[model samples]
Target: MSISLSIHGAAHTVTGSCYLLQSGRTRFLIDCGMFQGSKTLKALNYGDFPFKPEEIDFVLLTHAHIDHSGLIPKLVKHGFAGPIYATHGTIDLLSCMLPDSAHIQEMEVSQLNRRNVRRGRPEVTPIYTVQDAESALRAFSPVTYDEWIEPAEGVRARFWNAGHILGSASIEIELTTGLDSPRLMRLLFSGDIGPEVTSFHPVPESPQGLDYVICESTYGARERPQMTLASRRDLLAAEANDALKDNGVLIIPSFAVERTQELLSDLLALAKERRIPRAPIFLDSPLAIRATEVFMDHADELEDGEAFRHAMRSPLLRTTESAQESRMIERIDGSHIIVAASGMCDAGRIRHHLKNHLWRANATVLMVGYQAEGSLGRILQNGTRAVRIQGDEVKVRARIRTLDIFSGHADGTALTQWIEDRGPVSRGIILVHGEEEGLTALHDRLAKKGLDGDRIFAPELDAVFDLLAESPSKRERPAPRRLQPEVVGQLDWHNDLSRLWLDIEEELEKAADDKARRVVLRRIRRALENERS
Candidate 1:
């Protein structure tokens, strides 16, 4: 018997969430995601999987966010025929999201390949296609809240409403794995906990004592996120009023899922109350329009969704067609708000709007979501007055503003409060899903109170730790960039056939005969030949 956990992704960085757990011969993986952000990291999207895809037994998804679920199509293409577990709502969102992600991949990869051709370099390909995404969608297995869904022989799991997003869940897992027998252990995975006490949903209960808990710290070091739903409501009203005075466009870059819905609902309330001057609001991005509709379908998950009990209210101003998006952008009247997707301003119609509006002093640019480093949104957030959009240098004269309210993640104080409420239990703590600075801040704060003996650990990318397996003779793990010698040979870095002899010698040391070892060597050489030509 053995127990091991491998951090496949989302260790040092925020995106590409994945981890593998093993008990005896059965292997389970959680959150197979695509990496986003910088080019170097983005290339991980095209990497050869560390393990054989066919060997994977199951996949547990956290939600439908691209960073958390975008790689599913690639997994399916690689021959993974396992059950992909998620909530019903997540399934709906994925139905909309996965196809869109593939579309973006195609657009981006084709552009990159064009540049590669110009530079006399090898052309890269999209990891998967739209058809692959369709195939992957067929593998979804939906589970409800508080229901135990067993994955393997010794693992029992259940999902709780995390209130982070529609159908987002915090999972509780019980694993019984022993070096020689069965030993019980409890584990909890926080699936992107929500904005505390927002206008739409109530904050969920802090998951309590367990043998081990894997909690996310997305905002572990920040102060209450600097915004709330109440403040955001007021801000929206005030901004709309100000923009009405000037009669200019208000461009909002928002995530397609919950954030877009929250903004629309807030705007709808303002429209009903006449709190601000009335103007036609544009809900651009067909994907967002579809997502908002899906959100409304899940009224049972919303707190104010019950407000419909008093009187039925429309959720968001969903523009159904691309023509609507174009018509609004082309001929928008004074001071109207326009919301679009690819929240980072890195892509989408927002780019067109920024090019159209950024130079005007009367126009306003409002940011609502967390912009990762290197995105156009971050440049705007950092107070850059001018930036490039679509290869053109554009001046930024619009009054840049931010209302970080409507966060779906719990902040530092909330993380602390949740931890304290969980009562004294096991001391071992593993901090995940945070930047280095944020994780350090939380670690120091927890250190002061001595909760659970401060066994806090933030594992490195690809780090391996075995809690139940006996420590083997100390051997350094291979670097991630180094896969098989065949992969290395494909680079044409080693022309000599015997270049890999030493490593092969060590690898086949325990073989019974030289004949068997030579066969293995021949197979590796053949694989190298395939990759090269």
Candidate 2:
């Protein structure tokens, strides 16, 4: 029997990157991420898991980003009693991230409950808890890069640095069945590549001898501008200098994991140089500070050969106690620059700051990360004159600026450039993690670059693709399939309708747990061919 891979999540859109893989009687999950951005995507976070959590043999994590690892505690809560695997850095980060995420979910749910009191709507409980987070972490087994481990029967796993963040990796898999005609399944899951080769870390080397490729195309439609390390520093300094005119607050909405550390390191260097005025710069967001400490613990991943040396010279300001955070907020009333988490201005202390400063026009709101659709950061980035927070619509007077060069995600041109360097790994490539616009844009470009739609496909979330044994003597290259926008428009009414064409090969009994899953997977695969054509 042939092994299979499913587009469990991050198929069409960038968030909630879960992929289900199977070989023989074994099953496992990869990157149990959460859905973010617009309501449409958020709806996915509340839906069923599709497969029985207890039945999954194990879980493998790519990194600790909320989108890639936020749902682990929830999975554990839902009966996934198996062990989880990740890198040492990922484990440390997740140790902090899981509890933080659980706290947020609980707080958000509580807030919703309060609102429900008036509306009389049903209350929604949080997906997990602090205890759940702690419970999930107990199963984590940290492995370093390039180490081979068996995740499931016939499946061999290895990790390679993706350079996206500290401990982020691209997963490599090899599987061999115990049969006379044993087949080798070699697959690479490009777990969200980083933007550049930084002084803090090395770039991801292209893998060799890959048979199938599952790549991410988050910024799949745009060209990434070349930016030097010094240029990024200069850009932020200029922004700070401009904001320091009145000695007002400089609010940078950072991702709290990688970007926050990078900013903290940069600011520490500037403070030493006395480049900008040294008003008390506060590092709020308990999660960000804790996550930064995790970075320090795993400082081996930090770049530039002297991160340890630099730490010795100028240590970080990572606060822990509640009073420390309060102190940071209180100092903001004076001439101070405050760096907080939730980079997209979605929630946390950053939102409180925005509530206070949105109408002041004295403060500066600087964004240094990607702002997904429907996020407060995007609303401000779009030049919205006014915005709402919590309940009040605050007038926009604060200076709004976004510096994209500091973003961790690789843009469209970079992703294509990386794919171009592939040395015959596999002709068939599937692009994941992007909006429909981004995916469609990338699909057309890849086609022009000689990877026609038949050779390279961008799948929709929950979409499925079938692999058949390749002919040894006569292999035909697949032709580009024309986009059926009209058909796609019709699909607005009903989804995955192509299952009507199922034949005897539509074996649902052979799939996980039920005949329905078999039918659903089969139809989802058929829908892909029609949706593209």
Candidate 3:
């Protein structure tokens, strides 16, 4: 019997990575990630799994990024009980990140319910709770890199450092039939491969001898400009000098994982060399601080392990763990740098920081990571004059800047080089976790390398291709009804209108007299009437 693979998620987008593999009686999954990006994409998170969760044997998690591992709690909550295998570094990071993800879900649900209660709408529970996340954690089985193990019957797998994050890895699986059969298959999954190298980690080694390859093309259409560690420090110093010109707050909205730690190292290096002033630096996200500790625990996996450990203890750095402490940061006077989480500014304490300082001309929000399409960070990056945060309209007067040196994913050129180094594949390549443009560009490059057009497959959402078949055939199955993008957009607009109406209601309630209330209500009515007309 031949092993068959199904492309479940991350086929035409950059998030929600999941794949189903089947071999005779055994079935397994890889990367049960949460969908992210525009509201249309995020709705996929609440949809049913393509395959029954309870039927899968186990999950092979690539890394701990929410885009890659956020749905583990939801998976476990849906009745999955098998082991979730990952690298040692990934396991430690998950220990902190999963609970934080659960907390965010609970808080979001609570906030929504508060509004629902006032609006007479039914309250909705979170997709998964903290207990669910904790339960998922119990199923994790940590394995070191370069070691092979049998996660399921008749299958062997190994993890190779992807250099994307602290414990990120590219997985290799070898499947064989019965002892009497001579057929065997080797499959490789590139789980968000990192760049050539970062300040914290060395370049990832390419895996060889692959029968088939499932790869990511997140940055496949463009190449990153060359930047060295020294240049990266210089760029940070320049941004700091510009932002701190008049004792201003320099806010860096970073991801809680590798990005935050990398920024800390660069900032500390700059301060130590006197290239930048020794400003008060606050690590504001509780999740990021916890992940930083995990980085410390696995310092040996980093490039300059000793330097990373020392930088975490720098006098210029302080961590804010509690809500009270986070609020206390606003009381801090003078030039200071605050690094917070939810890099996209979609959630977390970064919104609080943005709300407080975004209106100040002297403040600056330095973006050091990729911001998804509908994220607040992207809106700011696009130079929006105003944004609604926590139902309050916040002006955007703060200086906004971005430095690409901090990105963990490889560029198009780097990805091409890595693929070239990985040698030839006997079967074919399936490109996932990228947009259409990137996928097309990468596919063209692969075609030039002798891969035929028919062999390079880029499936759409829910589209499946059987790997073990004689030729690629679109699976014929009953398609489930999914909300159309237009419908999703309409729903999003409704939510926005509801929030605006609530803001108006609150304003009217605060009015001092009947006349004032009448004026506010009239304005709201007029605005709605004008919109209709």
lDDT winner: 3
Better of 1 and 3 by lDDT: 3
Segments of candidate 3 deviating more than 4 angstroms? 177-181, 472-533
Error of 3 at 171 (Å): 0.5
Cα lDDT computed for each candidate against the true fold? 0.73, 0.74, 0.83
TM-scores of all candidate predictions against the true structure: 0.83, 0.84, 0.90
Clashes of 3: 1
Top TM-score prediction, candidate number: 3
For model 1, residues 210-287, the per-residue Cα lDDT tens digits are 755666776778786456556777888887677667677778899888888877778877777788766767777777
TM-score of 1: 0.83
How many pairs of residues collide in each model?
1, 2, 1
The better-scoring model by TM-score among 1 and 2 is 2
Tens-place lDDT digits, model 3, residues 1-533:
64667766776678788888888788998898887666667777877887899998999999999999999999999989899999989999999999999999899889989999999999988878999999999999989889999987688999998989989999998888544655778888999988764887778865786878888988888777788887778888999999987898899999999999999998988988888889989999999999999989988878989899998889999999999999999999899999998898988999999999999999999999877656677778888766778878776899999887888989888877777777677777788888777889988887787767676777666654555666644432223434432332122553456346656756877899999999998987899899999
Cα lDDT, model 1, residue 406: 65
Segments in model 2 whose C-alpha atoms lie over 4 Å from true places? 177-180, 305-324, 327-334, 469-533
Backbone clash total for model 1 is: 1
How high is the lDDT of residue 525 in model 2?
A: 78
lDDT of 2 by residue, 430-514 (tens): 7888767778877787777776467677665565444434631222223222222222211221112222322222454346676
